[model samples]
Target chain A: MSTDTAEKYHKHTPAPIDCNNVVISLRNIRKSFGSLEVLKGVDLDVCKGENVVVLGRSGSGKSVLIKIIAALLRPDEGTVRVLGKEIDQLDARELQELRSKIGFSFQGSALYDGMTVRANLEFPLVRNQRKLTRQEVDKAIRQVLDDVGLSRTIDQMPAELSGGQKKRIGIARTLILHPEIMLYDEPTAGLDPVTSVEINDLINDVQQRYNTSAVIITHDLTCAKATGERLVILSEGKFLRQGSFEEVFHNDDPIIKDFYNYNFISDS
Target chain B: MKVFFLRIYDIYQFSLRFWKEAFLPPYEYKEVFNQFFEVGIKSLSIISLTGFITGLVFTKQSRSSLAEFGATSWLPSLMAIALLRALAPLVTALIIAGKVGSNIGAEIGSMRVTEQIEAMEVSSTNPFKFLVVSRVLATTCIVPVLAIYMGFIGLLGAFVNVYNNEQTSFVSFFQEAFMKITFLDLFTLVLKSAIYGYTIGMAGCFNGYYADQGTVGVGRAANTAVVVSMFLIFIEEMLIVTLINTYR
Candidate 1:
């Protein structure tokens, strides 16, 4: 961390932390499409203001697990609870209501291709909270855009943005609702290494500033190390190993070591 | 043939899920307006412009056949009847199935394949309400309006063609043309347009929502959505015509 950034962190008192307050919990979750079981009997818990990252190979269902936590996909079996409310049982209306409190960043920079950057950021805010005046919404939009370092691109469309810029705008749009938990799917995918570092820094800064927990899914080991305090490797449909980043990194178990060393390991 | 049947079954399931997602809503108005502007208005000029030329060219080609029987005076009524009954709605819908329907399918299919839809799910926003319902409702509500616009333009095109070919005042032409059209005929036209709109919207959304595999899956969804919806529209039109004639 830079001295300038460290000083800023020291200057601002961190938000109140509820170490034991579980904001999100998933129990024995399972999902399958046809005969392919993507996630099988997975369990996870995220505390308030925690940064938890799921790491795995491309198809190990790390992303699927996060999606289930977000309540986007229904589990074939088990329960997911967000903000202490069980989500899987909720009807569509209730699900939408729950979504406003959670910010999600898509892997592909899923900004509406035709909408301007400002308009893209304004989408969830305008839809969920219609009571905000145009000025109020604009003010918030400017703040979030500035935070993501894309204020100058407000008038530009998604097609005009670079990959890094698109991801920033996607993050800004995610912040529109001031969600309690930020969900990121491969936030740094396809970016240059320098841009990837910048995005990782931004993720860290946002988590501290907003005091929100994060559930990040990524295959990039650099990103996993840079952004996460807690790391877990997902293998098959279950968590193969999980611990603090340093612990997971230093562990010498065959699967963990093989995963770190990039050795192919067949299912035994 | 087996794949086609499986696809039909899949589309049926997709439509049911879409409907369930649509009404149970925290609605996403931005996506709705975005789709409406694209699918309904952006495609308008093409549909109307094509309808107009089709009407004019039909008149030019059929004129000789009518004159051979000395039925020239019946041309106005015949044009009006044809435009209102089937040609306008059927042709306009086929064009939309190719244009707007495929666009919807591809857009949503790409979202699905890329895991963007999954992102929306984890963020607490119901992807169905935000993505699927918005496009479906927008298309359903706007297609009928497009049909009406196309029907009017087609009549105007026929008028210009008739005037260029033979001297006839606007008042006389409308008087003769409208004489044969009853409230029933107009209602039937509107009803068919509404059904076409529903079917087109449903098919496009279904294809996109359930699109699996990868890039190839999205392409197939879009292609199949257009072809199947077009076929269904024609089949339904023929069936409606038979039912109407049988009752008469």
Candidate 2:
């Protein structure tokens, strides 16, 4: 293939790897603190190029499940595999190597207050791939900044930006690594409706552009509707329901229906 | 009391895990270096500036008392020995433990409370390695450097005081100080200062790493770490004095 064609394919149409290419899989995962069982045998899967949304009320182990998948929290029992590598079995070095392929957008934006937006974007980039020439780093910065539509504010300190701009910068920083999978924890939590939609659309655009899988943890049904192809709901550390958006909306369970209807109007 | 014991256990376990994670690597050198810059180098000016003023003030105070005893000539040597042997390192470390310790505690505590540390974990980054190790290592290595720097500046301040107060020439003042100052005493001073640095840095970073209850918790950690480290430095200095007296 010509370089241009390869670049085009890389950006637009990645040769389908596998429709069921499970990017992340969790089986019989359990987590606890002292006597509190946080995640009770939670099982989940995100296929290649799928957007999986997890919904739950506060304290519902939705965030915990995502943490397990990302290898942030170790399960007291069971297995978590990402890209076919068992995460829990890997040592810290191996784990960091594995995490290089994953990008996480924090719920709070988590931009280092001491650093500017540009420096934050450059952080993982410089660490993971050290040989990128200065020009390449700058170009990568511009590209990711452009991707998140915050190129104009690249030099601004994180504190100088508005709430939505900070989120955009956070997303932009996550994109720098070109992760195979992107995990978002309450990406739209504190934003106004308009900015929330913009962030949701940005997540969608990233998925389509990179053919990346996503697992978004949120309580906002609107976010679930906009980003996830499949919706999974949790309660008391167990998977309460899981299906495609249509299957989930028409679910016989009143709890699921109530959640689906509640988000449908507010988001639309 | 049980809760108190549990908190101590929590801190001990955190330090243990931090060391294990930090040593096993794909080490985050950039983060460590960045923290070193923040915790060590950035805090240097205040420590040095304060040490200089402290030495000058001590000399001025000591001169008046010693003058009544007809021992005014001992001022330069006394100031040098006190600043070099004890005061500079102890004061700088207390200040550092207060300023940098609280800052790290707050930074890491907020990261924990906000789930930024969790975000790092899920991104496959070892939060301990990236956050805790880098911070501890930076403080361990950088605080010593700061101690040495502060000690030198404090000595210069003493020299300035002697030059102004007793109308002594720099050469005569230093000659007198050298006659009184032993190699063992200088060595002990450097050793104590380095120990003080390590103690302050480790305590501050450790408190921050395991901070609980959000911002209030971070504030408490920072405050407690400084106070505890300051107390420990004095106790350790006394213990060292006892050891040196017994051993020598």
lDDT of every model, 2 decimals: 0.80, 0.78
What overall lDDT, based on C-alpha atoms, would model 2 receive against the true structure?
0.78
Docking outcome class, model 2 = medium
DockQ (CA atoms), all models: 0.50, 0.50
For candidate 1, what is the TM-score? 0.86
DockQ of 2: 0.50
Docking band of candidate 1 = medium
Tens digit of per-residue lDDT, candidate 1, span A1-268: 1122212222222345576999989999999989999988989888898778898888899777877877767899999999888996778668877887888888887777656988777766777787999999999999998888888999998889999998898888888788889888988889997898889888887888777888889887667777776788888888987876557756667766666555222222
Best by TM-score: 2
Worst 10 residues of 1 chain A by lDDT: A1-10
- After TM-score superposition, the amount by which residue A1's alpha carbon in candidate 2 deviates from its true location, in angstroms, is 50
TM-score for chain B in model 2: 0.87
Tell me each candidate's RMSD, in Å, in order.
Answer: 5.0, 6.2
